[model samples]
Target: MPFDQPLPREVKVTDSASLFRLEERACDLSLNSRLDPAWVRANAALDGAHYLWPALWNSLAHRPEVPRQLRCELLITLRAGDRVVSWLDVLPADFNPLPRVTSREEGMQVSQLLDRAPSVREWLLREGGGSGQQ
Candidate 1:
């Protein structure tokens, strides 16, 4: 589906976590919306990978210009049977870090998270994963 495709109803986001969970849930509702939580974990350029994944997702889901290659990888990973129960599960067991969006401001948190995602940066470079493709 295109980014412009509207769902039947909108998810109200009262907080960053809620917004994150809603987007994650949306990913499961359709293959067109699925994301590779593992790839987000490994490639996001954040100190606390666990929290930033959802924040980034919530932010990007609104935008129209997500890199085609990144979208393809997210969809491809789903077909490979990579299931993510929670963003928490994406982190290493020893990874104990505070939430990135403690202020409960979804927009600010989303901006900060996307600013730190290496894959987002790589996509911006237009090299498609800093190579021909990722």
Candidate 2:
């Protein structure tokens, strides 16, 4: 599938999981708050802040074809006083047949991320993608 084109009907994400993911992302996007010093301090670090988890999940689910060799970046911005800071996280995926097609590498990659939900949740509450750090 070409990046410029849309997902095919079979994987277009019409099911509950995909739809919910999209909704979650929308919520994350809408949850941005002004980053006051107190807010930053409460969060420990400005970089610790994220756009919300739903956004991250939705983002990943929305574009399920991230190239393995390439690093993916998702940026979330916060307004701290007069400064707007950006936090970046990665959503790594491999869209090739490695160790042959239908291999477990892809599954493991996704599973590894899913296992880090605590960090991802914190991230969702704080910059955008689920990684705890920028």
Candidate 3:
């Protein structure tokens, strides 16, 4: 996928085990990085439908170390049952899912955090325009 392309909105994982594996891989990659995998696992119940959206990929495009597959990928949101559990930026090549935030409150917090990054804020605002939310 190219950096200009957008990812699918949602990815359903019927198997909890598969989700676990993905999470484990993400967690392992996350270690020694900006995100704390243990804290993410402890806070969020990552076992349900996975939502995806393009994250701050453009910011990482200049880095040769980041894989192309991951550079144009989407961020993952784990939902356990009906509740939104966690948000992760999965980086398999480098450091894994950099856990962003959890819960509704944290979601808002992350939004604020994203706003601090100009590129991300612009991308989000542009992408969010036709989301059908009034």
| Full-model lDDT for every candidate | 0.31, 0.29, 0.37
Q: For model 2, where is the 10-residue window of minimal lDDT?
A: 7-16
State the lDDT of candidate 2 residue by residue for 27-107, as single tens digits: 343322222223333333234222211112123444445321211121223233222222222122221111221335744
lDDT of 1 at 79: 22
The order by descending TM-score is 3, 1, 2
RMSD of each: 13.2, 14.6, 12.7
TM-score of 2: 0.21
The 10-residue segment of model 3 with minimum total lDDT is 71-80
lDDT, candidate 3, 1-134, per-residue tens: 45685543223232334344545665554421122334334423455333333344433445566444332222223332222323344453422343323466755543443334233224336546221111
lDDT of 2: 0.29
TM-score versus the correct structure, for each prediction? 0.25, 0.21, 0.35
